[model samples]
Target: MRPRRFGARTGETQLRSEEYRLLRDLISERLGLFFGPELRSSLERRLRERLGVRGLDSFADYYQLLAYGAAGHEEWDEAAELLTTHETYFFREDYQLRAFQQEILPLLAKKERKRMQIWSAGCSTGEEAYTIAMLILDSGLFEPLADWEIRVHGSDLSKRCIAAARRGIYGGASFRATADVARGRWFVPSLVEEGKSGVSASVRSLCHFAQMNLLDDERTNLVGKCDVIFCRNVVLYFDAAARKRVIDMFYERLVPGGVLLLGHAESLLNVSTAFELLHLKEDLVYRKPLASTAKP
Candidate 1:
């Protein structure tokens, strides 16, 4: 059957009351991304393009495609990429990072473990994970950790972003917040793309990437426990319930005494109370309680 076509003005129709509720609810349930009344037009505009692509004239039809179509799963994935934000760059939040480097790393170093793991949850294009690895290498704390296991894992909901991450190549915009010293030390000229550079083999060696939905319990479990988790700027998109759920998952994924770093705009104030807020010289971070009364 020929796909339905829509006129310029027809596609511009406001998302209907029922359609808005249906689409928003479905997206929230599946992806944990909440779109409220304020975002109604935004959601309508973004999905209208999808409807045009699919040759469906109405938002209702698009909802049917997402909810009951033969390729519903694939459709959801595409919609997710469209709806989610991937605005990130290397060393985007320097203050929190400085705290992680100056204060947190030293504390972890004292543990004297054979393996160390750091997770960049919601890691968009892999910069955060690579940055953590670079900092670890720069700290020179791991020199004494030779023969020890060290891995920085980055996970995101966008498959495309994860693919870009695994390739380990980036261009100028991804380096906007990056320092020249870090750029010089951790990346070399890219062989495949002119004017682009790939993360140095040494940095890439310690990092891994995977496509994962933060709301997926089984897949999230694969992330296991980590010493530090960077989930900055991600929970802002979620509603209260979704935010709480994700926070609970983070708590589960972090080992005792593990650290949780959030964006400057986000905090656990009412979202959660399980974590203790620790103030560092550069930033404030959260941590799980240690088994003992004090640092081991």
Candidate 2:
């Protein structure tokens, strides 16, 4: 179907082809969020909600506000949150978690006189980072009870999500895949809201949260080198170039021999990454090879 035309008055719902291209490209460039032609209707609908909020008549006006307005920088944050999906939960992609717990953590245990860091890049609401903490504790490798500097940093583009993550509270949906034993062990019953739970003190102690854009060089450099990085389903929102950019950033962040775990839907198949495809018994993962290790 053809896109609707820009209307002459208020409450207009139109997003012309020119407007869509400008807005789509601007969003993709600024936020690394890609919406193909097939998603034009959905994109328009989402932008339509923004127009009403900004008191604009058309998506073109909204695009101008986003592209050239004084508040454009701030507006990009809102657009990022709206356009991106944040559907993460504790213990997502069980197979990948299994691979990490069963095979990877033991491998990291071999590293002597070194701190362990794991980054949950694009962590939506902090569940994944906490899960990593819980898994580390379960393995009994890290001496989490001691003063070991094991840090699980969780970063996301959304400031709002970061705030919620810091709060360390989650709703029922975030716990659907979680088992009763884990729930009883790792979470405390919510005082503010029923049916919600706060991440346990032990889990909270090991994790840190930050509001970060994957494309921002300065912020990523601040992450330092990590032993493992769990980026999961976040990268599928980006286009080819954006995907490569993110993959490269992941490589830089990881220490040599560090492993990267992605969602079942994501892979480095077509991307030119330095990461070697590491095969595990339960799953396939990518590992940044050590200086002595050759490409597989």
Candidate 3:
């Protein structure tokens, strides 16, 4: 599709085809993200805010700043933040969490390994990562192994988001799905803001946050191996090719027999065959096969 001819309007600035194509391609290549032609209007509006921040007037100027400016990489970080921040709440997708706590935890606890590492890939604002920790603690499975090491790492592409996650603070909106019992047990009133709360130190101690582009293999490797991966709703914005690449990365990161949980709307139908389908009592999940047990 060709760029739409945009003349200056009263308040809204137009994003030409040239600039949009360049920016879109860069975002896709770097972050495995996509914004189709239909989203041009919305994308333009969102990016216009960035232009205002930089005191620029044209999308082409912003594109040049992102493309060749010495500060381009820095500018891209802000742009990435704007483009990627999504609405998320604590205890989202409860059914899947139930499967994790009641069904999966016992089986995993039975394993010979005393240490458990869970990666909340694309964990936005730390809710999901913190939620997972609460579930694990609530399960009361690690009590037997007093010395067991438990850590939950949350990674996101937005630096702002990672910062927020690290701070462990949340507003009222984040607690919409959270039950009162869980909230009372794990959170305390926030000193920094009114009508908000922060995750308790006990729960915060079990979680870590970092800014990362999931498609970057070098950075991703630093996450080490994990026993279970929760990559919910994050891949829905990716193109098919990007989806496959990220899925492959997840496969490499998970230990044999480790589980990979996707959002309820997401599935591996055409993504990959390497992971075996696992039907849990409450939900369906996927797992990597042990080398000795894998089929030819």
| Cα-based lDDT for every prediction | 0.84, 0.84, 0.85
For model 1, the superposed segments whose C-alpha errors exceed 4 Å read 1-14, 292-296
Worst 10 residues of 1 by lDDT: 1-10
Which is better, 1 or 2, measured by lDDT?
1
| Candidate 3 lDDT over residue span 142-215, tens digit each | 88535788899999888888899998889989999999999999999999988889999878878999988888
Question: Which stretches of model 3 miss by more than 4 angstroms?
Answer: 1-12, 292-296
Residue clash pairs of candidate 2 = none
TM-score of each: 0.92, 0.92, 0.91
Clashes of 2: 0
The candidate, 1 or 3, that scores higher on TM-score is 1
Model 2 spans with C-alpha error above 4 angstroms: 1-11, 292-296
